[model samples]
Target chain A: MSEFDLIRKHLTGIGARRDDVVVDLGDDCAVLRVPHGRELAVSIDTLVAGVHFLPDCDAESLGWKSLAVGLSDLAATGAEPAWATLALTLPAADEAWLAAFCRGFAELAAAQDVRLVGGDLTRGPLTISVQVHGFVPAGHALRRAGARPGDLVCVSGALGDAGLALRHLQRGEPLDDYLRRRLERPVPRVELGELLRGLASAAIDLSDGLVADLGHILAASGCAAWVELDRLPLADQVAGVVAGQAAGGADWGLPLASGDDYELCFTLPPEHAAELSVLAAAARCPITRIGEVVPGSGLRLLTSDGHPWAGTVAGYDHFHG
Target chain B: MSEFDLIRKHLTGIGARRDDVVVDLGDDCAVLRVPHGRELAVSIDTLVAGVHFLPDCDAESLGWKSLAVGLSDLAATGAEPAWATLALTLPAADEAWLAAFCRGFAELAAAQDVRLVGGDLTRGPLTISVQVHGFVPAGHALRRAGARPGDLVCVSGALGDAGLALRHLQRGEPLDDYLRRRLERPVPRVELGELLRGLASAAIDLSDGLVADLGHILAASGCAAWVELDRLPLADQVAGVVAGQAAGGADWGLPLASGDDYELCFTLPPEHAAELSVLAAAARCPITRIGEVVPGSGLRLLTSDGHPWAGTVAGYDHFHG
Candidate 1:
């Protein structure tokens, strides 16, 4: 089959069907009708083999992760998933590989009710770029520049599991299935993001770990934050590893600096803190209050006993790391 | 510098700025207020080194062609350009190359009044993916499915010049400056596309040559077309190349079957034929009527003697070719 036929076979008649999409595939451009009183949110992300993923990584997981990460950006803005355009480059036309990849991509797209509106398939080194478009009510989108001095810093679900899984995989060590899944398939907090639309003061998705991702919030909001390392939520396996460390000298690098958590790190006013449990229940995800926004300009880490804690914290940089 | 630092240094404070952009760079997602009654037009294109262009292609021209082809998609749909997101992957962070690329990109963006809203920079084989968003009045966008029998098939500007330039470049032969620029920096006919919105019945951009690209409209419209070979508009250099061929046996392969010529091919009804000159004058692009839509299922080429012509015609396919 031609590349065009391969794309149509694997991509069409799978994702969500929406009325707002005036034109889908098979056109020079896809046409979308943005509902009145709604603003559109757009973001694009690209993943390259041997850089973003292992060269021999599973095609199914790669496809899921590609769309999931782009959706995470929409989640950060509290935008409802609407449509996505994919630009896929492959070394060759492998029918079995394309079928498997499309299955994984379609699964998440169906669950999220997002439609695939357009795509370009070309020949090159394996690279996947997904651009997602979402909708948010006028004047109601969450931003990264609204955090204030006295708000609570919160995160959803556990952290560091994905980082730990990557380390073990790199070392060729066996790991628990949960950790493996965490690294292979991350669930973006779309529901929780929408719930925070009017309540959370500021929001960002945790792709580059808490310290680094939250630093973006601080820089944009012109404020500082302090995170109590003891308050970080950890999975049971991760907690056991932390417990084995020497008392009060444990390294928090995995949770603080490792990437690919795909959770939400947001700030909320003290008065709205009462709604945390409701938001968590609605989203079906755990919510943890890990820290608080402060008055200054840099991130401050506090030890369990309330002493200022300092340790090297850095995030992944694709080019200069 | 860090990857984030490199992106900000090269991307910010450039391109068109508009009030509809609620959030731009440094945000998880760029939010835009789509004007009421306008449908969003979205398309994406990916250019890989050695596949779309030479591996050693000039960075500035690469940048121009990268975005121009995507805008050609918008032009095919009669959409007004608005915002763009760029996802760039490179082997390394070269400042000089990045600056030159940005200059070409910014120049076209400013000329088209398109805003640079978001971007991603990463490390990998050199690849550039540009997703452009535009606006078209509801129900007014041109499509490839409205052609009917008796419609006049038309094209904007001359064909085959870019293909000729590519041929010379691949053979390392001397070429005229005009032909060289045509291959390196072919202009997208965005203005002519918007002008054809209501006047044309079916439209498409000529990226994959006239025969193959026009085949798309035939398949979509469920009709056929007949082209008179003698009426084809050719640049002087291309005409000379054809003239030197043996009489009555000259190959039309370059004009009929080559790619990378970003021109428009549309069909107009007899009622609107009078407006062709007006559109050409307004868009400042030469218009030529070369064929007519007919009630058959496949393309029919006519020789100068008005007899059926038979020849081999095939367009570029990334995977199979």
Candidate 2:
């Protein structure tokens, strides 16, 4: 019944041995030998018990989502994954819960080859704070400010599934495997990001939905976008979930406003679009052409027929939610 | 009450700009131009309310201590101060609380010259997780495994003040500003650590008392230590606080067992002892010789008269406490 016991049992020995890791989990600080000519990319994300997920959510899923959230940031910046640190706060050290959580976290860590260098454990309300670090060659990191007016907007995967899953779960609607998977274990597109290193002009991960996140890109890049509503790759079971609701069939706008997709939303020059398709096929990850960048500001939703479309499309806001 | 509003009002525009920071606070991930030929030192520490600190502790103090906790890790590794990301969790958004907290955090951040590159804000029981990143030359960072036999053990600054402050506060005794400052704003010895780069063989921060923290270095280094109890630098005013206690006056054991005194404990080759005095004077961080490394294992506390001293000196344990 101590922090040391909890960490030693569950966290230690999880890091894969690497010479670059001069000091590992048990040290006051972990020393990592950054590659000689690469820049470091860093991000932090925190998930609370009830606020970020259901209090009754599975520990394995929570563990997966925690690191995935931070890794998604690396994907947005086109950085190759390197290492991660996790700060876990809990109400109590239940052995089963700790084991399950570590199992889920270790799987992802091994797959990504991200060494678990150092972290902290504490007693408190359930919270997971993960900070991930990666590297990219100098002067080649993707940026939100790099989008040009003639770029084509692309998305890596289906949107609105996680958000739709949340709504369905809250409303007592049964969820299929795909819907639940999207909500519980959304994938981070790190490989796809690496492939887009020179191809993508700008990129961002879709955590706060398309409108809000894409709006961020527009604001940062100082340009506008025209997203064709028909082009959105909606989740398969999402339409069924909406059909069962009182709001009628296939809420087309839902895909644009939903969050937690963790998919990459990026822009590329039209000339590079062909190269992206080849890369996308090689990655075996779906890449849909959702929109195009244009002059001026603001995210504009357009109809399939090239006319302006007006519909409420806003993303989740953490404080408001 | 949106997340964007909360962050824009309290967190954005707060980054201390630097040439190495390619992307700062507003991006999905912060990009740093890692100095060529330098390795990265990383660490994470989380402070939970009612565990790491009193629930009603001053927000200003909490903010300063939050970052200090992580910076202390960097000091233990002899890494030069660089950048940090803060994950702040709270039950509610009170403007006054946020403002006071940021004030304390910003002052220390400016003094250390570490940029506030990125972070996360969430709703939960109050907790602060800070991840700090710094730089050291390849293979030059201090490690707990390097304490060889015949090394002189040293500590930076005084100990037991924070422990005394906590004891007084818990016991409902009259409090003084000095003790409270020691508890709230204990300075991390980053500059002194950089000064000890090639001199100190092993280093660790005193977060969990001299006995427990020093034991870690001993265990890792495969060497034993004999600490001269009389040499421990206790607070000037702590004697008065202990005198007022009913059990005893100036309990010498408090400094050995009491935690939260964020001072650096390190070991050096005996030859470098003279050099440390000059470095200590230049850094304005007092260095005290309290012990020596021996061939055997385990920490042996000694009386001033060269006799074996036996005393109960276990530190704070998260689960047991």
Candidate 3:
């Protein structure tokens, strides 16, 4: 077992240092020179032991997902990932846990080419808070308020995998490798966000399920949406496991109400909507058009053939949990 | 009881908005436009219940001090306070606790003219993490690695009061108004730091006591410091409480090793050191000379008459605690 400050040795070697980092770790604050003409995009996310993840979740995956959550916010803003700071609180410091945690956190930081400039480690009930700072060109950040009535709603990558994975974990059922990986290590669509900067009118990361998250876009843009339920890109397991397992099994609701997907849900005008296919091919990730923005309030779900649909599932609520 | 997320209803009205805050809270990420020619100074600090503060400490005080800790880092770097984010984890959402917490936190954010941006809330252990973002001109941040031999060491405001207050709390001794205020609400020296930007060659915020915090400066600048113990400006309670109160009660070691002072300890050439008197007068905060930069490594403590000093006390170590 390891018992010491979590940041002392493990996190020292994580992340890729950048030239803009004037001051790094060991100082009171990290001084960064924001590139000229760039605006800073900042977001903070906290993962608790039982609220956000399983109490007995793997330390490595927890570390990775903590940073991934913050980075996903950056992706939603069309910002280029740059620097991050971690505030980690743990009950005890295990040497093995620290090593695995650092490895998981470092791999993602390296992939994004982001630097871990500073952080604080303390003793408390396990809670990890990561604040990510990225840079986007002035006036070019993707936002939730810019979608118009004529815009086409789109989502990148499969959606319900992580939510389905949560069902397994909650039911105490053993998760297969594919579902486990999706739940533990969700991808943050940084490149897709960067590519959609000027093309997409609005964007948001899917942390809550599709209906709730997309509802935010609708509320902010003062519009509504007609979502074709069958158009949702569901995970293989979600489609097969819950497709007809029970009466009114919410086959489509898995995507509509499943949270922690970490995918990009965005909207684009009709002229540029077709370009999403080419962009998806280049990114090697699937981007699906699931709905159309309409002039009204709230969202309407429709079946595969465009008939009206209904559901009673709600989005993830920490309070309820 | 406050059951919903803390950020939703309370924090929205806390701080004044800035023009540079293109997009504030209620988004995936807050978009901030950094003015041209300014670099970003970022710092994160977490306060955990029973670790960083008392388990039953006043909720309002906890909130105010959380933001103060991060702003102190900005002060150390001579950055102008601008924006902040909070990630608070709690076991339960009590409205009374939240109202008091927000009141204390908002007052400080308003006084500093710092905008409260985005944040995350979760259920877990009681911990508050605040990340402050400030701005300074490129290459103008006062860093610990800039001190040179023959520079005078200086500190803004009194020290050891907070440490003494901690002792009182730990020993179950009643605290006087002065001592209790010091412990609960630390004033971050943002003005002093900004004033000393071009004047002080190196600087650091005092959190881990004089010897340990200054030791960071010495190590980073590759120089040693000769600290005059008797010259330190100690609070009335710290001197009386620790001086001769017990066997070998030190008249000075309490301030020397006590942490949580949150004062700005900086260095400047002897030529500009005299101007500290004038600067202190204008700023209305005490700036005292307590040491000098020397050519060597580590810190050397001496009495008022310049005799060699000895001590066994170490700075605040989270691990040791």
Q: Which ten residues in a row have the lowest lDDT in candidate 1 chain B?
A: B242-251
Which tens-of-lDDT digit does each residue in B65-137 have in candidate 1? 8889999999999999998999999999998998888888888888899888989998999999999999999
> Predicted candidate 1: interface RMSD?
0.7
* Model 1 DockQ vs. reference: 0.86
TM-score of each: 0.97, 0.95, 0.95
Question: Compared with the true structure, what per-residue lDDT tens digits does model 1 show for residues A1-321?
Answer: 776788778877658999998988878999999999999999999999988888888889888888999898899899999898899999999888888887888888989999999889889999999999999999998999999999999999898898888888899999888998888788989999998999999999998889889999999999999999899999987777666665756777778878889999999999998889988999999999999999989889998989888667688778865
**Which digits, one per residue and each the tens of the lDDT, describe model 3 over residues A138-234?**
9999998889989999999988899888888899899999888889988799989898899999999999888888988998899999988778887
- What does candidate 2's lDDT look like per residue over B59-169, in tens digits? 988888888988898999989878999899988877789878887888788888888888788878898999998888887988888999999999999888899899889
Top-TM-score candidate index: 1
lDDT of 2 by residue, A144-188 (tens): 888889999999888889987898888888988888989998889
Q: Name the top lDDT candidate.
A: 1
At residue A204, give the lDDT of candidate 2.
93
Q: Between 1 and 3, whose TM-score is larger?
A: 1
Q: Report, for every candidate in turn, its global Cα lDDT versus the true structure.
A: 0.89, 0.85, 0.86
Once fitted onto the true fold, the runs of candidate 3 whose alpha carbons sit more than 4 angstroms away are A1-8, A249-253, B1-6, B246-253
DockQ for each model:
0.86, 0.81, 0.64
Residues B200-274, candidate 3: write the lDDT tens digits.
999999988898889889998999989887788977767676566557646565687778899999999899977
Pairs in clash, predicted candidate 1: none
